[model samples]
Target chain A: MSASAGSEQILHENTLYAEPVFHVGQFPITNSIISSWIVVLLVLVLAWSLRGKIKSVPRGLQNGLEMVFETFFGIFDSITGSRKRTLQFSPFVMAFFFFVLLNNWLGLFPGFGSIGQIVVEDGHKLFIPYLRGATADLNTTLALATIAVVVSHIAGVIAIGWWKYLNRFLNFKVLWEIPQKVIKEPTILLINPIKFFVGIIEIISELAKVASLSFRLFGNIFAGEVLLASMSAILAFGLPLPFMFLEVIVGLIQAIIFAILVLIYLHIATAAEEH
Target chain B: MESLVSIFHIDGKLFLAQLINFAIIFFVLYKFAFKPIAKIMQERTTTIEKSLDDAKAVAKKLAETGLEQTRVLNEAKKDALAIVEKANQAAEVNKQKLIEKTKLEVAAIMAGEKVKIAQEKEESLKEMKQEIAGLVILAVGKVIKEKMTDDKDKKLIAEIISR
Candidate 1:
C-alpha cells in the first residue's frame, strides 16, 4: 500500500543494504540493527523468565534448553575433538549460531519487508521497512565473521604461547631454525624459505576466511530474502510457500555451516604445534 | 575495494552495533544457559555413574549373601546327618549289649533250674528207698512171725535199686 508523506511518490523497492529506520543524534539505527536488537530482547526475556528457576532437575523450557545445549555440545565436540576444547570454543561459536539462526528465521516474520514508511528521498518516495534480517546485511555478517576469525587468533594465543601462535601466520621460527639445523639437515636451506612463504600465504588465507565466511552467510540469507520477494512478486500467494520452506531449511543450514566453520578455525588455531 | 564496499554498503558504525548485539546475546546465553546447563549435565552424569556403581555393589553383596546362606544351610544339613548316623550307631551297640545281657541272664536261670531239678530228683529217690526198706521189714515180720533182720541184704538191695 503506497501512502503519500508529501507530493513525492512512495518508492517501494528492496535495496541491497539495510535501510536506516531513524537517526539518533547522527547515529543511524538501521532496520537490520533493529532486528538484531529484537533478537537480543527475546533472549533477555527468555533468560529473565528462568533467572532463578534454573534447577538441577529442569522442567519445560529449561528442559528444552538443556536438550538443545546438549545437542550443540555434541555437534561442537565433533569439530573440536575434545570436550574441553569444545567448552572453550562453544560460547563464542554458539553465539554466532543463535544470532544468525534467529535473525534469519525471524526475518520471515510479517511487517519486515512489506511494511515501512513512504519517505521522499532524491525526489522519489522510498519504502523503508522498520526491520530487516540481521544476517542478510553485509555489516552484520561481516561483523560476526570478523569476530569469529579474530577470536580464533585470540584463542590461539591463549592455548599456545604467543610466540608459537604468532608463527602460524608469519613463521619466523622456520627462518630461525635454518642456521641451527641446516648443517644436520641440508634440506632446511630450501624447505625453510618455502615454509616461510607458505606461512605468508596463510596470512592471505586468513583474510580470505573472513571474506568467505561473511560473503557466504550474507549471500545465502540475502538471496533467500530476495528469492522470497521475487516469488511474492510473481504470485503473492502459495507460489512462495515452497521457497519459504526452502528458506527456513536454508536458514538453519547456513547457520550451522557458519558455526561449524568458525569452530574449525578455532580448532586449527588452538591445536599444538606438531613439528 | 571501494566498489565492493559501496555495493555491500559496509559501515563501521553498523558493524560495531551488530558486534555489540552479538556480545549481548553471548553474555546472556553464557551466563544464563550454557554454564548452568553444562554444570547440571555434569552432575547428572555423576549421579548416574554413582548409582550404577552402587547397584553393582548391591548386586555383588546380594550374591555373596546368597552364597553364605547356602553354605550355612549345607553345614547344618551335614551336621544333622552326622548326628543321626552317630545316634543310629549307638542304638545298634546298645541293642547288641541288651541281647547279650539277656542271653547271659537266661543261661544263668536255666543253670539254676537244672540244679534245682537234680536236687529234687535225688531227694525223692532217697525218700523212696527208705520207704521200700521199711516195707520189706514189715513183710518179713508178717510171714515169719519173728524179727529175722539181715542188714547186709538190706544194704545190697538198696544199692541195686539205686544203681
Candidate 2:
C-alpha cells in the first residue's frame, strides 16, 4: 500500500499515537501534568484565601474545611487505630487524598482530550496537543507509587528504628540462629527455612507494591477516559452524558482507592510487628 | 493485530513516567495544599480546645461564687436567729424582775398599814380605861352624898380629917 494512497492514511499524523503526551528528556510532562498544576493552583488559592478564618465555632468555609478534616481524621484513625498516629501522619494522608482527588477529577473536564493541537508524523496528521488525565498516564501513577512506597519506608524507619526496618529486607542474623534453634528442637530447621522463605517473599512483596499501586490507579483512570472517549465517538450526544456522570463516580472511587492504599501503606509501615 | 491486553501492558517507561509525575504532584501538593490545610486544621483544633478551657474556668468560677453566696446567707440567717433568741431571753428576765419587785413593794406597804392599825387600837383602849375609872369615882361620890344629909355629912367629914 502506498503511504498516501492507503485508506488508513489520515490528514493528521500524530493523532493516532497511543500515548498522547511525550517527554522532554527526563521530565515526563503531559496533559495530566498540566491538569495537576491547575489542581495545585486551585487548592493553593482556596487554602490561602481561607487561612485566617479558622474558628472554634465553625463558620462558613472553615466549617466546611473542618468537616472534611474530621472525616479524613476519622477514617484515618479507623485505619491507623490511633488518633495520635492519625494526627502524626495526617499531613501525608490528607495530601495524598487531595492530589489524587484533583488529578482524577481533572480528567473529567470538558475539552481536556478533545481540545488540543494536531501533530503530524509520518505523512499522517495526529491529534496530540494537550490535556490528558494525570492518572491515565503511567508516569503519574508510578511516580505516586514510588512516593507512597518510599515515604512509607521512611515512616517505617522513623517508627521502628532503621536496623529493625532493614531487617525486613535482609535477615542474615535470623538465618544464622537456625543452627542453635535446630539443636534445641529437631523441627526447628524446617520452621526456620519456612520463616526465611517467608521473609524473602516479604521482600518481593515490597517490590510488588510499586507495580500494584501504579497500575491499579492508571488502569482504572485510563480505562474510564478511554470508555468516555469511545462512547462519545460512537453516540456523539445523549448516550455519553449518563456515562459522564458514571465516570465522575468512578473518578471519585479511583481517587479514594489511591488515597486509601497510600494510607494503608503508611499504617503498615508505622505499625510494629509486636514480636 | 495485537490483542487489547497488549495495549495495557506494563513497561519501564510507563513506570518511570509515573514515578516522576508522582514526585512532582506530591511536592506541589505538599507545598501548596496539604501543608497549609493541615496547619489550618491544627490551629482550628487549638482554638476550639482553648475556648473549651475558658468555658471550664468560667464554670468553676460560677460554682465558687455560688458557694460563697450560700455561705454568706447561712451565716446571716444564723446571726439573725441568735439575736432574736438573746432578745427573747432578756425580755423574759426583765419581766420576772419587774414582777418580783412589785410584789416586794406591795408586801412592805401592807405590813406598815397593819402596824399603824395595831398602834391606834392600843391608844383607843387606854383612853377608854381612863374614862371608865373617872365615871366610877363620880358614881361613888354621888352614893355617899345621897346616904347622908348635907350639913351633918360635912361635919363628920371635917372631924375625921382632924383626927
Candidate 3:
C-alpha cells in the first residue's frame, strides 16, 4: 500500500488537530471543515427529499421519520418537563445531534483517513487526508458548545424577563433586598451575601458547562479516531473492525449526550427561579 | 493559551464555518422535516378524535331509535289486544241476544198452536152432538111417531153440545 510520490516517504500519524487541506483568501480549509460541509449537504438533501412527501397519513420514510421525531420529542419533553419548552429548543439540539453523529460515522468510512495526498514539507513527507470527523476537532465542538450555551441564555431571557435571567449569575436582586430584610429579619445579612457568592459560583459553572461540553465531545471522538488508527496500524485489517463498531456506538452515545446536555441547559435556563 | 491553540489548532474561521453549517442545517431541517411532520401528526390526532365523536353520536342515535321502535311495537300490541277483547265481548252479547229472541219466538208459536187446537176441538164436539141428537130424535120418532118438531130437536142438540 506504500506508494512513492517522490524521493520522500509518506508518514501517516493520528494528529490531535485537523490538518489544513486548502486555503481560500487567507482562510485555511481543514479536513474537519470538509467533513462538516459534507454532513450539512447530506442532511439538507435528505430533508429536502422528505419535504414534499410529508403527508397527514405518513407512509414509508415519512412514517419512520415521524416515529424517530416523536421518540426524540418525548426524550426532550422528559428533560424539559414541558412540551412547549421541548418544541422551542428542539431545532438547535437536533441539529447538534445529527451533525455530530454523521460526522462521527462518516469518519469511519473506508477512504476517509486512508485516501489523501503526499505533501513534502522541509524534505519531510506528510500524508494529509481530505476528510476528518468534525467533532474530533476542538474548534467544531467548541463552536457548537458556544452556540448551545449562548442560545440557552437567550432562551432564558426570552422565557423569563432579562432581569430575572440575569439574576441567575449576578443576583443583584438578593443583594439589594438585604437592606429591606435586615430590619425585619436580621439573618438576611449573613444569608444574602452567601446567596450572592453562590450566584457568582453559578457564573463559573456556566463557563464550566461550555468547557465540559466541548471537551467531552472532542475527547471521545478524537480518542476513537486515535484508537482506530492504532488498531489498523497494528494489524492493518481485522483488528480495527471491533474498534470501528465500538466507535460507532461511541459516536451515537456522544451525540445523544451532547443533545441531552443542551436540552437540560435549556430547561434549566428557561425555568422561573423560585425566590 | 498559545500552547493549547497550537496543539489543538483552534482556528476562528473554522469555528465560524462550523457554526454557519449547523445553523443552516437547523433551519432547513426545522422547515422541511420537523415542522411539517409535527403539523401532520397533530392533524391526524384531531381527525381521529373527530371520527370517534361522530361514531359515538351515531351509536347513541341508533340506540334511541331502537328504544322508540320497541316502545311503538309494545303500544301497538296493547291496542290490538284491547280491540280483540272488545270484539269478543260484542260477539258474546250478540249470541246471547239471538238465543233469548229464539226462545221467545218458540214460546209464542207454541201458545198460537194451543189456541188453534182448542178452537178445532170445540167445533168437532158441536158437530158430534148434533149427529147424536139427530139419531135420538130419529129413534123417538120411530117409537112415538115423530112427536117432537125440528126446532125443538135443534135446540136440544145445542144444549147437549154445550154441556
Best-performing candidate as measured by TM-score:
1
lDDT of 2 by residue, B1-163 (tens): 1442355333455556555544555565566545566676778778889999999999999999999999999999999999999999999999999999999999999999999999999989777655654454456458765645546655555464446
Give the per-residue lDDT digits (tens) of candidate 1, residues A80-163: 788998888887888788889999999988778888876767767688898899988999999999999999899889989899
Better of 1 and 3 by TM-score: 1
Model 2, C-alpha of B65: deviation from truth (Å): 4.7
Candidate 1 deviant stretches above 4 angstroms: A1-10, B132-147, B150-153
The fnat of each candidate, in order, is 0.73, 0.32, 0.85
TM-score of chain A of 2: 0.88
Question: Scored by CA lDDT, what does every candidate get?
Answer: 0.88, 0.72, 0.88
The true-versus-predicted C-alpha distance at residue A56 of model 2, in Å, is 6.4
Which of the two, 1 or 2, has more DockQ?
A: 1
lDDT comparing candidate 3 with the true structure: 0.88
Q: What is the overall TM-score of model 2 with all chains considered together?
A: 0.77
| Per-residue lDDT of model 3, residues A1-275, tens digit only | 33554545568888899999989988999998999899999988898789689888788878987887788999998888877877788877887888888888988888887777778777678999998888899999999999999999998999999998888889999999998889999999999999999999999999999999999999999999899888988998699998999999999999999999998998889888685
TM-scores of the models, in the given order? Answer: 0.93, 0.77, 0.89
Instruction: Identify the superior model by TM-score, candidate 1 or candidate 2.
Output: 1
- Candidate 3 off by > 4 Å: A1-9, B124-163
Worst 10 residues of 3 chain A by lDDT: A1-10
- The candidate with the higher DockQ, 2 or 3, is 3
For residue A203, model 2's alpha carbon misses the true position, in angstroms, by 2.4
